[model samples]
Target: MGNKLNQGWLYTDRINAKVVGQTVLDFYSQRYGHSDRQVWQERIELGQIAVDGKTVNPSYPLQAGQTLTYWRSPWAEPDVPLTLPVLYQDEDLWAIDKPVGLPVLPGGDFVYHTVLEQLKIQFPQESLFPLHRLGTGTSGLLLLGRSALGRRELSRQFRENLCRKIYRTLIGPCSLSEQFDCHQAIGKIPYPQLGYIYAATADGKSAHSYGRILARSPEKPGWK
Candidate 1:
């Protein structure tokens, strides 16, 4: 199979107060770290970086409230499953069976090879937005909003904790009770590779989950 490629993309960001005085090269190199300083300089020289709609040099100083736009060239993105099955649909909502290995939105190395872009191509006449998100490695039913009013209402439902969410997973053999409640707090922590990642910590936000054993495999000593 042939790999999918996006034509091009425009990445936009606003200069915040913390990094207002930094130059374009310093800002991009220190904050993003996706490209080396030399590559960023080359892109800047090629007019790929813009400030407030005007092309700027690498030494251009950024100011608070100014818009920064990066014209990213087209590139080959990682291949992923493109099939999206509709489990349910209504005038205001849609439930899609999202396959594993497919990213819910564009980020990192993925631009056009994303569920959001695919949905836009499939429903060109409609304005649809995901109500929530699922990880790239996760396969589950994803909910979407069909209209502005629908989005607002559904977002409120999630904020008020009215919607129920359940997840099933397979794990290695272990001893466990019939039912259990895990209250592990999760928050962002600095890492060596990525800037930061979410993990369990004492000073994190409260997170709770309830799990129950449905079945046990005698041969493998696994539970579900």
Candidate 2:
């Protein structure tokens, strides 16, 4: 596949009772809301579906709670601009304002059109290392280490929680207090089209976010 962006076993889940006793083809046809059995059968013949990590025949009997995995074919991604504005730069570190919709690293149909790849072309002499990453849909400032020693120092700060970053976001009306702190555990879970999903989970690392209501909608009219 040409750049194979956002493609993988992006879709995976455990089969439940409703699908038990049915053929894999039948289960998928119902599970995906597609009634065409022939279409699913073709995918099965290609070994696109796996049960308990093993490829099986299309007519393989479904089992309750068996893990099902599917590798999605490559799909097109938006042609977002690769270069971003340089907010700050020095011999050791570079802070760049990354645009929304641009991926930080290569994934899902995006290889050469990523921030990492673009930076390499922008600064051919010094080795560039990413200190952190932002979601493809997010727009914000990103920090990068320009050299090996710079990379290590910045990486240690993040790993040890010594570095703090503040993000600005706009949301709907809320009745929340002016200031608040949320200490919730967050982690990544497999999702369908987006690769991995990040959210609060019981079995996750500790995460903290501080929210301060800047202004209400009408109160802060004309706000970007």
Candidate 3:
């Protein structure tokens, strides 16, 4: 794969009163060198413009002190290692331990280099449908439905919250007890430089998590 060159965000600070009531298209045209309004207009349609940490319309009102972010399209896709281990497989479904760095589906600069594409290649005979998605940063078990019946049943279970997942991870010393349940709301907030926002919020969808301190690290102040 060729080296990725086209990935990043362009930022601008709204310090002066020069752009108070101007539309995003008008402001970019005046402030930036690109005189073609159509270009900026197209980028806005592609979800490339954000104000303060949220994507909004091109005509969004800009307030002083708010930050503007623009996503720059990459020139090429970067290389990502694709290594998935099948934990269980049958006529109905396959449980796969997906490796980190492989996207579950096409997004950003990835298209063919994704878990979906890889599974299609490996299980040419089975028509696989992903049950859920995990971020590229996480390596975990992914359930894939193999047939129409399997897809419908698994999807129904997930929708009704009948499925439970246990995640094991290492974390720093905690104030939490040996066992505790955390109820936190999950939502989306603007990512620092990335084009899209990520899940994190003070108040959002209801979520419950149970954690237990399995073991404490002997050398460092950490727990598993």
lDDT by residue (148-183, candidate 2, tens digit) is 878999999999989988877777667889999999
Candidate 1, residue 65: how far the Cα is off, in Å: 1.9
Model 3 vs. true fold: TM: 0.62
lDDT of each: 0.83, 0.78, 0.74
**TM-score (C-alpha, index-matched) for candidate 1:** 0.86
What's the TM for model 2? 0.62
Ranking by lDDT: 1, 2, 3
Off by more than 4 A, model 2 = 1-75, 218-224
Better of 1 and 2 by lDDT: 1
Q: List model 3 lDDT by residue over 136-180, tens digit each.
A: 777899999997888999999989989987777777656778999
Clashing pairs in 3: 6-74, 6-75
Question: Over the stretch 14-111, how does candidate 1's per-residue lDDT look in tens digits?
Answer: 99999988999999888777678999999889999999999999999999999989999887777778888989888899999999877777777766
- Segments in model 1 whose C-alpha atoms lie over 4 Å from true places: 187-204, 218-224
Query: Among these predicted structures, which one has the highest lDDT?
Result: 1
Candidate 2 clash total? 4
Error of 3 at 15 (Å): 34
Pairs with steric clashes in candidate 1: none
- Clash count per candidate: 0, 4, 2
